[model samples]
Target chain A: MLHRIEPRSGVAFTLKRGQRLKVSDPEGEQVADLLAFNADDVDEVISSGRTLDYASRIFLTTGDPLYSNRSNVMLRLEEDRVGRHDFLLTPCSADTFRIIYGDEHPHRGCFGNLAAALAPFGIGPDRIPIAFNVFMNVTVDGATGELKVEPPRSRAGDYTVFAAEMDLIIGLTACSALQSNNYAFKPIHYEILD
Target chain B: MLHRIEPRSGVAFTLKRGQRLKVSDPEGEQVADLLAFNADDVDEVISSGRTLDYASRIFLTTGDPLYSNRSNVMLRLEEDRVGRHDFLLTPCSADTFRIIYGDEHPHRGCFGNLAAALAPFGIGPDRIPIAFNVFMNVTVDGATGELKVEPPRSRAGDYTVFAAEMDLIIGLTACSALQSNNYAFKPIHYEILD
Candidate 1:
């Protein structure tokens, strides 16, 4: 069963292993990031590592430490809940925009926004790796086994915190509009510390 | 450069080209979609085109039509800014999670909760797509050319609406967490209609 995080001081803090975070949205989905770091901060993000990606708001784990093309540590994971929830995957790309939106829109290569944000670090579409999603839930059709995005089981103040083993750059965004699955949107909070 | 969408009425509405939307999160970001349909159905998503991925909570633009993925018809657009000031974005995936967080922690193959949510879709480690950062803001340094994630430029009651040209699935999450940033975690509200 899913659980909500209750900070000891009545205020939510960062997440740690063996901790549970909960969230509740009015009618839509609620998303949040547990932690994130820069890839270039560590010696090497070995495979079978773990960390959080703030941009996609999901937890990540790897079998090998991720290395930036610049030879910097991209990320490493300590723990994960991918089997439990629909952790985030990869960021939407400009190519996705073309495929989903069509070619008639004003913005031709809209993925440029995300690329621009990562450009300073020399990160690009080809270099962008998969992301992780934490806490959020996605229901699967038991019969067909098809996956569907579901309302999160998390409530307000529910959180998870992780310790950073390396330097990293984290990016997160609270979704703005989700009319596709009804107005099932909710608010979420996050916290991180040393 | 960006604008806001304000409906004259309180009921949920649609938006067309040349419209605007606004948000008020103090340092919040807003994302909007353009649809092709104008029916009173919840699952009437058309094309998920023309996304206002990173608009400040103060004011945004919705004059452009979000394109469609499968159909040719463009969804009409409308505007209605009601309810609390909440914007959202869905998390990404595991490989991405690794790229961003692996260096900070120690674990591998951990996709966190997002993987669980997407598992049902057969969207394995290889199928995840890059996500869109709807409302978060990041600035790039001019002289040093460094990218910095910063506060948003929006406020409450500002919104942008679009018409669905085809059936689309919209994803969102309200974010106000300040674990990595300087702002305090706040809640945001959102609404949608035909």
Candidate 2:
């Protein structure tokens, strides 16, 4: 078993087949965005469209097979607790701050974090894709189909586990959408174990 | 082919099996949120969680099936052009007004329009679910796991077509997310075909 723990800041790593990754919110109420890619061919990556097409779902949970663009099975939901990871909404990027909050927005966004994390791995923006928004409280109104980007519904120690189906290039970002009503982008507990 | 075009406003209809519904951004860059219910049991309606769980996807596109909470297939994506509808983001609502944008943001939202439209059908707030956010520009940066919510990538008159798998009660709302960087909430084009 291989185990590595990365803090809430943006982080990236590779996991061999059968190795698993566990992401947790120690203080709770924090959301994290996660992305994964095929170590061999970055072009063959996770696709929300194709995954939803094959699984027929909009939100993700335990025991689900995460699919790639060509319908390749990339990972499996080995364990989950917060049950409500947002695979739907996009993460806030630096450009997102400029576009939504303006150019002077002080906080750094998930884009820069993920980009820098992957830069050492020789990955670039063109190879990037949206992430699996973990622990984010995004719910739809049962009355009018309105969607809300609320805070995570989890308590301290809530976590989810993912198993790599193949060699995987992983990008992880602690979400920094401060206006999302959280005190701050809390630290994320990331561990990869064999 | 039963064809009816509803202007950019909330509209409700009962689609029988084999019927098809087309939602369009006639002038372009408009988003339409859609919600569906089982004509037999409204309780077993659209579940964003289950839909994404089953599909292993976050975005909707051509040939994808919309599933209910009970995992029943509701609608199938027959065709799509501006393939960016948000099933992840919640539609703006009345209570949501004071929550996110505070009490000051003007412009009517999808909730009011959808509620009024479904009022005649006796579908109340408890029955509504997060809509399929159509043509809403939501993309993620794969390398850094950054998400972006910009305007639609469609040109004028691009559209998506959905086929009803079962008898469905659909409530359509032209998004009036006034904060979504437009002159105002632009009107959308809704047409139901045979």
Compose the digit string of candidate 1's lDDT tens values, residues A93-174: 4444444434444231212333454456554433333333344454433222233445555444444333343445443333
**How many pairs collide in each candidate, listed in order?**
167, 32
User: How does the DockQ of candidate 1 come out?
Assistant: 0.02
Q: Distance from true position, residue A192, model 2, in Å?
A: 1.3
Report the Cα lDDT for residue A70, model 2: 43
Which runs of model 2 end up more than 4 angstroms from their true locations? A1-8, A142-145, A179-181, B1-194
Docking tier of model 1: it is incorrect
Rate residue A93 of model 2 by lDDT: 60
Q: Work out the TM-score per prediction.
A: 0.32, 0.51
DockQ of each: 0.02, 0.03
RMSD in order of candidates: 21.2, 17.8
Q: Residue by residue across B1-194, what tens digits does model 1's lDDT show?
A: 33222211011233433333232332344322111232333222222212222111211234433333222334333543322211122232333334544545422221223233334433232222222233444342222222334554444444444445444333322332231123444433444443
